[model samples]
Structure formats: structure tokens, C-alpha cells
Target chain A: MKPSDHDNEHLLHHFSDMDQQRESAKLGMWIFLITELLLFGGLFGFYTFYRAWNPDIFHNAHAALDVRAGTANTIVLILSSVTIALAVRSLQLDRRRRAGKFLLATVALAAVFMVIKYFEYSHKIHLGQLPGKYYHYTGIEGTNPHIFFSVYFTLTGLHGLHVLAGMGFIAWLAIRTFRNHFSAAYFTPVEMAGLYWHLVDMIWIYLFPLLYLVG
Target chain B: MAHATAHKKPHVLPLKVYLRVGAALLVLTLVTVAVSFVHLGPYNLVVAMLIASLKATLVALFFMHLLYDSKLYFLVFASALGTIALFIVLTLFDTLRRGDIYEEVSRPITPDAVIYSDTARFDTAHGQALPEEGLMPLDTAGIVSPPLDTGEIGEQVDTSDIGRIRTGPGEGGR
Candidate 1:
């Protein structure tokens, strides 16, 4: 099929037009998000198993977490999620400059989340609260407190990596958006990236309370 | 009618809706933190998880555009979550029900379960003060004491001399 101003110029021949292309792209992203959910699910499953087996240890070890840092990062990610949502809205409305700015804000907020995560991780490391057999912090003691750090580091480290990846995606999307490549007729990339960014924030929404506020 | 398929735009959430959802998420996070400090015993975990799930729902609905999206997308995500929940529940079912799986009555005893009276040797003589058969040193208030001369339990250990954590399997090699 030939491209029309009504559809996206980059529409492929296999797809009939841009709407078809956008629907297919979104469905594809949702499929990919399913797999991503499963990937995180494996770690979360392990966490549930261990947490159930040793509730006391999980709670005790989690008490050492910095609630302030966790809370701050939660706020940053929530704000970033809002910004990314706004960026997608702007692209849908043909406001390329405003969309680019929102994307940049999302990227900056994601970086801040990563920076705060780094500090939280470093403090844990300095206190010798390492994972598995390497855990050496002595204040909290329960049956295998090391296992708590094991789950903690695994979950949060994976989450931090996702944040970094989302930032990269948004950064690239922002650049393309500023190049005027995206308009109301064609902003699929921005939407897909925004979905991914939202998943990052979604994962942290659970992680904040799971790891930090276990009580 | 056929030409109508060419211009189906994606749903764009209003700016106000996005802000409302974001504000709700932040408020829920605050509520999660505030509730964690309250000692509701077992209910604390449940409440924390409930709040976390609420926050996750908000992100998925508003931030991910699932609320306005096709039902197929929401179905896929919900199915994925259901599968994960099933896996966790099943695995925990096996792990939680093994009360007697680790117990070994026929084997040689491992030094009387490492009692408080003696870490190396199991001496019933030191436990003579206790009414029970175990070596638990209980005060009149019925509190177990650590073998160390340090203060009561929950005190931070002397971590100044603590070296790097050991890094091996069953090495206990600090």
C-alpha cells in the first residue's frame, strides 16, 4: 500500500496503512510487555517464597532500608511517569516541542531515580549487608538474613537496570521527537516507549513497599 | 465505511486525568509508608501489599494507558500476572508444608542443637538451674540471654572489628 498524508510515511507494505501499523505496533508492545512481566515475575516469585519461609528475617532485614531514599525515589518515578504520559499526549496532539521537553524531563527524572538507587546500594554495601554468604552486617539477626539481601539486591538491581534502559529509550525518543519525525499522525514510538517507562515505574511502585516498608 | 479504518487515532488521556492519577499514586505511597510503622501484627504485610497493589494499578491504568487501550492488551497483562501468582502460590505450597522434611531422628545428634549453655559441648550440668530439659537460661522474667557478656538482645554487635563478608558456599569463612 502506498503511504498517504492520512497515514504514516514510514508505514510498511505489509500493513495496509498507519492506523493498522499503530495498532499492530501497540499489540506487539503489549506482547513484549507480557514477557517482561514474566521476567520480573521470576524474581518476585522467589521473593515471595523466601519471604514466606522467613518472615521474621525479611522484616528485620528490611528495617535497615532507608525509607527516606525509597520514598524520594518513589516520588521521582511517579513524577517521571506523569511526564512521560504528558509527552505521549503532546505527541498525539502534534505538540512536538512540548513533547520533547516532557520526554527530556522523564529522562532526567529516571536518572535521578538511578542516582538515588546508587546511594542506597552503596550504603548497604558499606555496612557489609551484602547478599548470600557475603552478608556481614551484625545489627539485625534472624535465620539467614543474608537471604533477605539476596532478594533485595536482586529485585532492586534488576529494577535499576530497567530504569536505565527506560531512560535510554526515552532519550532516543526525545531526540527523534525533536527532529519533527513524530506528529499527530505518527507517534507510535513515543507511545510504546511511554508504556515501557510506565512499566518501570509500575515495578518500583511495588518494590518501594515490598523492600523498604515491610515493617 | 472501509475508509474509516485509515484514521483511527489512539486514545489520549486528558492532562487533568493524568495529574489526578499521579497525585493519587503519590498519596498512596505516603499512605503505604505511614501504615508500615503501625504494628498491626500480621495485618501490616497485608496492608502494605494492598497499598502497593493499589499503586501498581494506578500506574497501569493511567500511565500505561491500559484503561483506554484495547481489551486484548489488558487481558494479556492480567493473564501474565495471574500466571505469576499461580507459580508463587504453588511453589510456596510445597515449601511451606515441609514441617518434618528436615528433621532427622536416626542420625547422630549435632551437639544437642547448639544450646546457650554450651556452644561446643552439651552439658546438662549447666542447665540444672532451669526447670525445663533444655539449656535455655531464663531469668525470672523468662527472657533468653545470649552467651555473650554484651547487653540484652537487639544491640548492634561490635562491628568495628568486623572484616569483609565471606564469599563462598557453606564456608562460614569470615
Candidate 2:
């Protein structure tokens, strides 16, 4: 066995071996992801009720949102997910520089997504389409249009927060990649981070259509 | 020759499959946008949600590598979905039941009560008059009626009072 492998064994002492450590970390990520889903799950449940009760208002409100921006963000996130996967793959091949480059690309793509989202949200707010108590779009006049905006803001706001958090994780992984901290046998952190970033992307895949495309 | 036996089997998907999956996701997004233009009533919402779910599945299976992960991960995911489903069903049941109570309470108590009215009384130089009760005239007459104890419009029904509507349990027992 390599001397470095023996030295690395003590680095993650929670497990008896590196394989066990990798498995546990992956499992821990899935559990965290499950909790994350449930957090969004409550908002989704609220949406279903409001949509069923006020379908017309929900549809008309949804029509006001920009589908093009949503679609662009979806594509951007999907591409980022691909790049992050490639970063993991590069790490697995012991190419730290390639992994670092891919991580940087992933972060840049995420920044692009956030920029698009900022414009999308600000445009709506400028048009007096604020959510909940801040809603000022009395022109579209409905019995309770505020409810639709409430669900829209709550769901997308939570998802956007996830994107920001994912960016931080990606930045951390990028720093580690720069330091040549990960190799074929020690890339669990990068892999776990990739899995989480992909989940964030997966959520946007659903949100784009639900909030923007459909009317 | 001995080095060949030491290599571990690759567990990842072929590169072509990933590319194809990516292409399919792109196509699905286009399909979703196209579908949204049609006015399908309630089905419009259903179709959009269904398409979004399909796209989410593709990303989860391929991009997230859940296809090769342990069953424990899937169990965790399934449990989350199950919890969401429970919340949807129970909350909808409660909300829909409340709608029925609203309908019952909104039913008029008398033929004259068929038209909903907001009663306002004004004091003037002349005698008091109930506006909807015809004590006030079409153009010239000015009369005021003290806020009478006429009771609620549906008060005679004994079941659809404000208390019942507010509490949701009085008339919603069924």
C-alpha cells in the first residue's frame, strides 16, 4: 500500500476505512437532501391547494411571469450540473487542474443563473407584481390574487436560497481543488457537493415550468 | 497481464448516454413550453405538472446518479414524497369541506334576502328611512333610520350564523 494512503487513513477517523467513509458521506448527503425536499414539500402542498381553489387566478398570474428567463436559467443550471459532474470525473482521473477548471466553469454558470434571476425578479417588482403583502398589481383584479403571488414568491425564494448556498459549496470545492486536496481515492467531498448541486438544478427544472411556462 | 486483473470495473454510464439524456431534457423543456399555449382548462395545470415531474426524474436519475445509489437513498426520497402527499390530501380535504360550509351559510333565508345588501343608516332633518326598505325615495327624499336591531339576514336559519361560519365546525359536522 502507498505510504500516503496509510497517512490519509487517520484523516477521516470516523470510519475504519476510506470506503466506509465514502459510503457514510454519501448516505449523509442523501439524508440531508431528503430533509431539503421536505422543506420545499410544504410549499408545494400549499401551492396545490391554492391552485385547485383558484385555478383561474393562478393561471393568469403565472402568465405574467417570464418563461424565456426561466428557460434560460434552466439550461444554464443543467449545463452547470454537467460541468460539475465532469469536475468530479476529472478528479477521479487524478487531474486536479482539469477539475479546478471545471469547478470554475460551474461557478461562472451559476453566477449567470443568479444574474438572470435578479433581472427577472426586479422586472416583476418594477411592474408592481410584488408577492403577498407587497403586491401592488390591482389591475389584474381578482378576489384574492395575493394568494397566487404568495405561493410564487415563497417557492421560488426558497429555491433561490438553495442556489446561493450551492454556490458557496461550489466555491469551497473549487478552493480545495486548487490546493490539490482531492485525488481518485479522496474525492468524496467533490462528489457529494456535485450531487447536491445537481439536486438544486433538478429543482429548477420543475420550478421553471410550474411558475413560468404554464398559465 | 497481471495488471489487467487488478483494475476495478467502471460503474459510471457511457458518455453517449449522458449526452442523450441531456438532449432529451432539452427537448422536454421545449415540449413543456409548447404545451402551455393551449387552453386546456384544469388539464393545463395537470399537464404542466406532469411534464415538470418527468423532467425532474430525468435529472435525478442521470445527473444525480440516483440510478446507481443505494436503496436507502431511494427510500429516503420516497418517504419525503409520501409525506408531501399526505399533506396535500389532508389539507385539501379540510379546505374543500370548509367551502361546502361557506356555500350553506351563503344561502338566503328569505326571498327578499336573495339580493345581498350592505345596510347603512343616515340621520337627516326628516324622519328615518330604511334605504332598501323603500323609506328613502328615488331622487329627492332624505330620511334617516337608526341602526335597528334587525338581526343578521341568515339569523333565522339558526345554523349559519357568523359564529358557525367563523368556527367551521357548527354547520360542517357532516
Candidate 3:
């Protein structure tokens, strides 16, 4: 028997083996991620309805968004995704310390993303380009300009929360890695967390183009 | 258990693969952003979405390791995406159709066809306007009364000319 084949303590009693346990966890995470997708799907549906109904308004309102900030955030998320994936790969190689460092790098990148997002949001708020009834910006020349901002804020806001949650998950993984809790045999949590971070990046992949570029 | 199988090792991709996918995503991101600047008119959305989908596929297949993993994960993810497509398509069908209905229903009535000369209010084609007090019961039985206007209030709302106003394009309730 190979040394790596020995089952570690991470295997649950219900699972027949480590492979089954890891596959189960990964499958469960994918399922939950889809649920998250569905939740965002509803908002996307709302956006489609409004954009279809008032194409002119959506087009005009999109100009209010800072594309520079959005592009920066997009790059930040893609980099974070890389870092987190590397972190998982590190764990797979049993480089626990390196895994923690990569995880911390991802966290730092996520924080930078939030900072850029904060500036964009505050700028919008300062200009009264808010969602719904609070919308008072008079620059847009169309009916119900507020509707576009409403969809924008809601979609990005929810996505931001997901980013925050991913950061938390990665931070937890980093802590666990420092404690020497995971190795090549039992890094399901790190892999799962990496999947989640990628999912978050995937969401931004769509959101960036739709909200900022598509108009 | 029936599902129990031999221990399978996790797949670990090389650093180059991750780096390559990461570079591709960044390039695609820039391409999408750059594409937005060129006015494709309506096709802007199409092109942007296509590029973004390509980027998302790369992330799913490589960074998320769906390419290396079992097909079951891809199945679940693809089905979820299909469901979202149905949600958006069905919703748009309803919303766009409803918009057409509203446009048809709310058309403005033309001003030339005078229904009630006394009030000059566009007759809602229903002719449910109350007849003046002490006046003969309105001949609301589809009688084409002359479009006469005395231009005086309470001058006996001409029941004889009661239903003559041909309701214009605004007659939508029918």
C-alpha cells in the first residue's frame, strides 16, 4: 500500500473512503453554488425585463458607472481567483505554509476589490444616482432612470456580499492550513473553497460586461 | 456499500495550466472591455456576452477544475444554467407582451368627436353619463344623435343627441 493511500482523520464515518467523502463534499458545494446562481438569476431576470422595456434608459444610465473602477475590480477578482487556485494546488502538494500564503494573498486582493467598489458606490451616492426613489440625478434623459440604477445596485450589492463571504471562507482555510489540518489526502475544504472563489469570479465575469458594458 | 470504490487520488494541475487560464481570462476581460468602446449598436450586448461567456467557461473548466473532475459536476452546473435561461426567457416573454397590451390600451382619444357637448369630456363609449335632472331619459340605445353643442351647462343635456359621439382610437375596452 502506498503511504498516500492511508485514510486520514478527515474522513467521516458515513463515507466509505476518502475519495467518496471528498467527492460528496465537492458535489454538495456545487449544489449550493447553483442555488446561489438561481438567487442571482432572479435579479438578472429583473434586469432583463427593465432593460428590454426601457432600452434607452438602461443605455443612458450605464454611462453613470465608472467603467475604470469596474475593470479594475474585474482584474482584481481574476487575480484573486488565481491566488486561491494556487492555494488549493499548494495544499494538494502538502505545502501547507505556502497554501496559507496564497490564501492570504487572495484575501488581500479581495480587500482591494472591496476598496475600489467602495469608491464607486460612494461616488454614485454622492451624486444622488441611487436606486429607486432615492434616485435624484437629473442628468439622464429617459423615463424612470432610477430603474436602471436599482438593478445595478442590487446585482452588484449581492455580488459584493458573495465576495465578502468568499474572503471569510478563504481566511478560515488559511487558518486551518496554518494549524496543519490539511494535506494532500484531505484538502477537500481548500478545494471546495477555491471552487467557491472561482464561482464568485465567474459571477463578476458576467456582471462586469452586463452592467458596465452592455448598457 | 454498492457505491464504494477504490481510493482515487485528487487531480493536481501544473502551475502552467493555471497560469495559462488566468492569462486567458485577463485577456478576455480586456477584450470585452475594449469591445464595449466600439459602437456595435445592439450587437454590443451580443459580443460582450459572448466574450464574457468564454471567460466564464474557462474559469469553470480550468480554475474550478470541472475539466478534470467528473462529468456529474458539469451536468449539475449546466442544468442550473438552463433553468436560469428558462427563467429569463419566460419572464421576458410575459413582460414584453404586457408592454404591448399597455400601449394599445392607453391610446389618447381624439378631440374632434364631441360626445357630451355640455361637459366636452370624451365619451367613454359606455354613455354611462347621468342624464340631467328633470330631463327625458337619455336615448342610450345606440341612437346616433346629431353632434350638436349648445355650449351651455344644465341646458338640458341633449338626450336626443346623447350617443352620437363616435369614440375614436381611444375606445379600447371592447
Best by lDDT: 3
CAPRI-style quality class for the chain A–B interface of candidate 2: acceptable
Single out the weakest 10-residue window by summed lDDT for candidate 3 chain B: B104-113
Residues B41-94, model 1: lDDT tens digits: 888889988988988888888788778777888998999999999988888777
Tens digit of lDDT per residue, candidate 2, span A16-108? 555557678888988898888888878877777667666667777887788888888888888888888888777766778999999999999
Candidates in order, TM-scores: namely 0.79, 0.78, 0.80
Local accuracy of candidate 3 as per-residue lDDT tens digits, B1-174:
111133453477889999999999999989999989999899999999899899999999999888989999999999999999998998777766753432311111112223324554323564444444433234555332322244232222222222112322322232
The top-ranked prediction according to DockQ is 1
Candidate 1 chain B, run of 10 with poorest lDDT: B156-165
**Share of native interface contacts recovered by each model:** 0.75, 0.51, 0.72
Model 3: colliding residue pairs: none
Ranking by lDDT: 3, 1, 2
Q: Provide chain B's TM-score, model 1.
A: 0.55
Interface RMSD of 2: 7.2
TM-score, candidate number 1: 0.79
Off by over 4 Å in 3: A1-7, B1-10, B104-174
Error of 2 at B18 (Å): 2.5
Candidate 3 per-residue lDDT, tens place, A49-79, comes to 7687678888999999989999999999999
